[model samples]
Target: MLLVCVFGGLGTMVRYIFDVSIRRWWHHAFPLATLLVNVIASFCAGMAAAGYVYHTVDQATSLMFVAGFLGGMSTFSAAVSEMVSLARNRRWWLAFSYALMSMVVPLVCAAAGWGLVAVTR
Candidate 1:
């Protein structure tokens, strides 16, 4: 539990840093930072899942990674907020695109990450 808390805190800090760093150069109304972070978290989660399945990662560590680190890293609420903001501002197309990408991209990234790890064995 302590380990998970530590990892979760670390994950939140990493997410904040990543968001700030990306926003420095992003200069767009779109929530690119959140999207990228979630995608990354999903990919890492897939890798961790595969690692656990293959007995390369122990249960506690896997729990720490999935429930602690990845949980803190990904931001579904932020994504939805961004979508709502876009829609409120009448950027229908952009909002729709963002919504679709938010759903599909992370899944694909996770699958790709899983396949990469699975193939290594």
Candidate 2:
């Protein structure tokens, strides 16, 4: 429990820093920070799953990564809010594109993470 809390705090701080960094680079109506964080979190979560499957790491470590770290990093609520904001602003096409890509890219990245583990093993 202590480890999870510590890791979660670390993850949250990292997420904040990363989001701020990216926001500085790209100023737009889209939610680039949330998308980037989610993609990274999904990939890390996939890696954590693979770690458990391949026994590269113990269950506790996997849980810490998935439930603590990635849990803190990813923001599903923020994604939904951004989509709503875009829709409210009448950016239907951008909202649709964001929604579609947000769904697809994370899956691809996660699959890639799993494939990486399999291939390496």
Candidate 3:
């Protein structure tokens, strides 16, 4: 819907802000920008999903936050970039850890949301 589009735009803007801000502050070897964005967005997504399931949010708000903001904020491209960087550096273990951790954390967050909704309501 229109609301989702608007929020999606906002989310993209927010992601850019976070990306740029972090890159400015911490321009080191590691990819702190992408890691920070993905983790925070995942948390937000979990909270939004819980809120919607528990009826703490209406449909429009759910669409905006869950489907739009979280979608825009989480960056698969960044993850791929990080993996590429690791491969280029020949840090295969670190690259594998990065990939594994990314998958584990998001799944855990989603499960946490689902469990919270089931228990609370």
Please tell me which predicted candidate would have the highest TM-score against the true structure: 1
lDDT of 1 by residue, 4-102 (tens): 988888888899999999999999888899999999999999899999999999999999989898888889999999999999999999899999999
Query: Which wins on lDDT, candidate 2 or candidate 3?
Result: 2
Cα lDDT listed for each candidate: 0.93, 0.89, 0.80
Overall local distance difference test of candidate 3: 0.80
Off by over 4 Å in 2: none
lDDT of 2 by residue, 1-121 (tens): 8888888888899999998999998989888999999999988787778879999989998988888888888888889889999999999998999999899999999998888888888
Task: Write the number of the candidate with greater lDDT, choosing between 1 and 3.
Answer: 1
Clashes of each: 0, 0, 0
On lDDT, the stronger of 1 and 2 is 1
The most accurate candidate by lDDT is 1
- Residue 21 C-alpha lDDT in model 2: 97
lDDT of 3 by residue, 12-111 (tens): 8999998899888896766777777787787777777777868888878888887888888889888888988898999888788788877787777777
> CA RMSD for every model?
0.8, 1.0, 2.4
- In angstroms, give how far residue 49 of model 3 lies from its true place: 1.1
As a whole number from 0 to 100, the lDDT of residue 6 in candidate 3 is: 79
